[model samples]
Target chain A: EAGVTQSPRYAVLQEGQAVSFWCDPISGHDTLYWYQQPRDQGPQLLVYFRDEAVIDNSQLPSDRFSAVRPKGTNSTLKIQSAKQGDTATYLCASSFPGLGGHTNTGQLYFGEGSKLTVL
Target chain B: AQSVTQPDARVTVSEGASLQLRCKYSSSVTPYLFWYVQYPRQGLQLLLKYYSGDPVVQGVNGFEAEFSKSNSSFHLRKASVHWSDSAVYFCAVSIDNNRIFFGDGTQLVVKP
Candidate 1:
C-alpha cells in the first residue's frame, strides 16, 4: 500500500509570501494530521482531522495558518503570510480509527514532508 | 499539560556498540508514549509505542523501548547499532483524545 504522500518536497519563499502544502492520505484512513518540524526539533502537531471535520487546531497559528480536508481524502495546509520562523518541514500523517473511540489505530504513517525555507 | 524531554541533544557511539536514548515525560495521567526516527531528509517514522500491557515493546529496524511508570520515562534501546542507525530520534506523549507532544530529539552518530 502506498504511504501518505506530499507534494513540493521543498519550498522556498520570502517573508509575507504565501505557500500551501498538499497531502494525499492513505486510502481508507479516517484521520489526518499536520505537523511542523523545525531544524533539530521533533515534529509538532499543528492540526488534525477526522473525516472532513477538524478535530483539533488549537496549536495552529490562527492568523496566518489554515488547513482543510474538504473531501476527507486529500488535505492542504496554507500559510497566508509566511514568516522566517515558519521555515520548517511540514509533515502530513494518516491513520485508521479503531473500534473504540478513545483507542485509535495508534499508528501514524507519515509522508516525506514539505520543507519550507522562508527568508 | 503534558510534555516530553530528551536530555541528550547528541550522542556518539562506535559501530557495533550498544545504544540507549533517554526520554522522560510529565503527565498526571497514563499517557501514550512513542518513539520515532528520522533519516536524512526524511519524515519521522515510528520506532515503538507504549499504550498498555507489557513494559517492553519492539519496533521496526531492531529497535525497542521500555516504559517505566515509576520514572515517567520510556527509553529506546538497541543491542548493537550500525552506521546506518545514525539518525535523529524523537520521543512523544499523547493524552486521550489529544494531539501528540514531541521532544526536541536526540541525534545519534554511529562512527565506523
Candidate 2:
C-alpha cells in the first residue's frame, strides 16, 4: 500500500516570497492533516480536513497560511509572504476514521515532509 | 485541551542496554496515546498505541509502552537497544481523533 506523498522535499526562498506544499494522502483515508515542525521540535497541527470539509484550522495563521483539500484526496498548504520564521518542515499525514465515533488505534501515516527555508 | 510532555530532550544509552522514554499527558477523559519514531530526514512512524484495556501495548521493532492512568504517563521501553534505534521519539494524545497533540520529542542516541 502506498503511503502519503508530498511534493518538493525541500524548498529555499527569500523573505516575502510565497510557497506552496502539496500532499497526496493515502487512498480511502478520510482524514488529512498538515503540520509544521520547527527544527528540534515536534509537529504542530496547522490544519485538517475530513472529506473536503475543514475540521479545524484554529492554529493556522489566517494572514499568511492557507490550506485546501478540494477533492478530499489531495491537499495544498500555502504561505503568503513567507518570513524567516516560516523555515520549518511541513508534514502531511492521513488516517482512516474508526467506527462508532472513535479512533481505531489512532495511527497516522506521514510523508517525507517538505522542508522550507526562508532566508 | 489535551497536551503531551516529553521531559527528556535527549538521552544516550549503550548498545544492548535497556531503554526507557518518558511521556506524560493531560486530559479530562481517557485519551488515545501513541508513540512515534522519526529517523533522520524521515517522517514519523507509529511505534505503538494504547486505547483501552491492557496498560501495556507492544509495538513494532520490539518496542513497548506501558500506560499508567493513575500517573497519567505512558513510557516507551525496550529490553535491548540497537544502534538503529537512534531517533526522535514523540508522545502524542488524541482526544477525538480529529486532532492530535504531540510533544517536543526525545532524541535517543544509542552508542555502539
Candidate 3:
C-alpha cells in the first residue's frame, strides 16, 4: 500500500512570508491530520478532518494557520505571515477507523513531512 | 481532555541490554493508547497499541507494551536492544477515534 505523500519536502521562508504544505493521504483513508513537529520534539496536533469536515482545530493558530481537505483525499495546511517560531516540520497523517484488528483503534500512517524553515 | 506523557526525554542503553520506555496518560475513561517509533528522516510508524483485553500486547520486531489501568501507563519494552533500535518513540492516545494527542517523545540511543 502506498503511504501518505507530502509535497515540497523542504520549505525556506522569511518572516511575514506565506507557505502552504500539501498532502495526499493513503487511498481509502477518511481521517486526515496535520501536526507540527519542532526540532527534536514530537508532533503536536494542529488540526484534523474526518472526510471534508473538520473535527478539531483548537490547537491551530487561527489567526495565521488554516487547513482544508476539499476532496477528503488531499489536504493543505497554510501558514500566513510565518514567523521564526513556525520553523518546524509540518506532518500529515491519515488513519482508517477500526484498524489494528481492533474496533476504532485508529492507527495513524504518517508522511515523511514537509520541513519548514523560517529565517 | 486526554493527553499522553513520556517522562524520559532521552535514554541510552548498551547493545543487548533490556530497555523500557515509560508512558503515562490522563483521561476520564479508558482510551486507546499507542506507541510509535520514528527512524531518522522517516515518518512515525506504529509499534504497538492497547485498548482492552490483554494488558500485554506484542508488536513488530520484538516490541511489546504492557498496559496498566491502575497506573494509567502503557510502557514499551524490549528484552534486548540493538543499534538499529535507536530512534525516537512517541506515546499517543485517542479519544473517540476523533481527537488524538501525542507525547513529546523519548529518544532512544542504543550504543554498540
Ranking by lDDT: 2, 3, 1
Q: Between candidates 1 and 2, which one is better according to DockQ?
A: 2
- State which candidate, 1 or 2, has the greater lDDT: 2
**Model 1, range A68-88, lDDT digits (tens) per residue?**
999999999999999999999
What's the distance in Å from true for residue A72, model 1? 0.4
Least well predicted 10-residue stretch by lDDT in candidate 3 chain B: B93-102
What lDDT tens digits, residue by residue, belong to model 1 across residues B10-71?
99999999999999999989899999888887767888888899999999888999999999
- Stretches of candidate 1 exceeding 4 Å from the true structure: none
Worst ten-residue run, lDDT, model 3 chain A?
A: A97-106
Give all candidates' CA lDDT scores: 0.92, 0.94, 0.92
iRMSD of all candidate structures: 1.9, 1.6, 1.9
What tens-digit string does per-residue lDDT give for candidate 3 at B1-112?
A: 8989899999999999999999999999999898999999899999988878999999989999999999999999999999999999999998776667889999999998
- The C-alpha stretches of model 2 lying farther than 4 A from their native spots are A100-105
Q: What are the per-residue Cα lDDT tens digits for candidate 3 across A45-73?
A: 99998889898899999999999999889
lDDT (10s digit) by residue, model 2, range A1-119: 98899998999999999999999999999889999999999999999888899989999999999999999999999999999999999999999978864553378999999999999
Off by over 4 Å in 3: A99-104
Between prediction 2 and prediction 3, which has the larger TM-score?
Answer: 2
Query: What TM-score does each of the candidates earn?
Result: 0.96, 0.97, 0.95
DockQ list for all candidates: 0.64, 0.73, 0.62
Residue B112 lDDT, candidate 3, scale 0-100: 88
